[model samples]
Target: MVVERRSLIIDEREAASWIRDGMTIAIGGFINSSHPMAIVRQIIRRGVRDLTVIGPASGGLDLDLLIGAGCVRKLVTAYMGGEHYCPVAPMFRAAVERGELQVWECDEGMYYCALRAAAQRLPFTPWKAGIGTSFPDVNPEIKVFTDPIKGEPLLAVPAIRPDIALIYAAHADPYGNVQHIGTGFGDRALWRAADRTIVQVERIIPNEEVRKNPLATSLYGVDAIVRAPYGSHPFAAPGYYIEDAAHLREYVAAATAYAKHGDRGPFEAYLRKYVLEPETHADYLEVIGIKRLISLHEY
Candidate 1:
């Protein structure tokens, strides 16, 4: 008998190619942290459209960029904003206001239940929190049901099954063992809910290093691994660097200008500068400049 081991390592472009139009895709990262921006940009560059995006609990540009680029047809998430910088994502608001996009309303608890239901291969998960609220009215999919065993009313949360999931992590091995320095949040659950998972990491460590701390390994059997140093650029990656506040402010300003005055120049210019023109991840880093990248860590 002969044994051979295969590596899951792939480049960013290839990872982006795994996605197709009309697929339900999930993005990992809570708010502006640990987002796989490199792969997200590549997806935009590839011109993949009509996607149903399942956003993280608190998503920012990772979801906004897709919506702004017309890649996403529907968004599913609890919130979309830049945290303290911006209350609501400008492009997302504009799209919703103009009837250009569809939103699947869900709160944090409902969102978790949906993903959990999918991960557990269950039809639906019943929750008591939304029974008395306006959740059923707002989201028609949520139904008030009576639990047979408990004989109590509960909201039935449906499963959110994504075709693919994109995640960013601190370290991973070629064998697809992933590790995150800080909190994984709902990311692991998102992984289990999706059919396939693609991860971009700051470093590709040795299998021995990964084996040293098996408990630290956040995920296993990831479908693809892309080595992307500072991969979560403009966002924070635990154990690596912090968010780029100046760049975020620049994005917010451009997006806000577009939303307020319908001025496409500033917003289009941003897309061209950071997204369209960057043929590769290295080019994006160059456009971000060495000084700016260094400052993220110092500040």
Candidate 2:
């Protein structure tokens, strides 16, 4: 008997359908790089609601966009901010301040360990990442236990097995094998920990080409793959492009106004112009203008 592999190529809309209301979603990225912004836009367009969003460390626009769109009911992350420049994520801060969003704050190291536990199919993992801090007090769900072997105190964080994982990469093949160029981040762990992994890439090449460089093919256990050029727009993709600082600044200003004034006007206008108006990612690229996007690309 011979085994056959199925192609996992899918469109952004179809990728959004894989996520349902109230499902736990893990997005791959650090603060401002390699985020699956295209899929996040699609999910907003689909009007998916009541989602539990998970970010590895701190997420920038990707998490803020979802929060602003009212798609996230709960956020599980180590930190939520605009890295160093933008200070705070306006939408996220607004929601939290208004008691509209629930947050499960985990230490960055503990968050990674929890995902690793999920990937290994374990119930929980023991580590000292959060034992000596106020995190254990604020988040009582994270328990402390005595290690049997060393007779030492350790903290246990539950495994985070998200219903779906959305990630962006530089390249992928038909069989869902993906390759990322720099700072791989927690993408690999997210891919393995989620029940379904949807990868958006800049390009889809032949499977033979993907296999040729086995080391570069760092991602596996992917369920779906979509081709989305400029997928991580406004955020850097290392060798592919630089961060769109101007656009980010614009967002920060708009979101801050909304948060401070309790007015939805500026944020709504921003959403309508950027997200709702564009029927597809291609349309978005066109709206961004070819010349402007090309200027951001790395030579």
> Highest lDDT among the candidates is held by which one?
1
Measured against the true structure, the TM-scores of the candidates, in listed sequence, are 0.97, 0.95
The window of 10 residues in a row where model 2 has the poorest summed lDDT is 79-88
94-206 in candidate 1: lDDT tens per residue? 99999999988989999989999999999888988877888899888889998999999989999989999999999999999999989977789889999999989999999
Q: Can you list the residue pairs that collide in candidate 1? A: none
Which candidate number maximizes TM-score? 1
**Candidate 1 local Cα displacement, residue 58, angstroms:** 1.5
Question: Relative to the unseen true structure, what is the C-alpha lDDT of residue 292 in candidate 1, on a scale of 0 to 100?
Answer: 84
Off by over 4 Å in 2: 1-5
User: Against the correct fold, how does model 1 do in TM-score?
Assistant: 0.97
Q: Report, for every candidate in turn, its global Cα lDDT versus the true structure.
A: 0.91, 0.86
Q: Name the runs in model 1 displaced over 4 angstroms.
A: none
Per-prediction CA RMSD (Å)? 1.2, 1.8
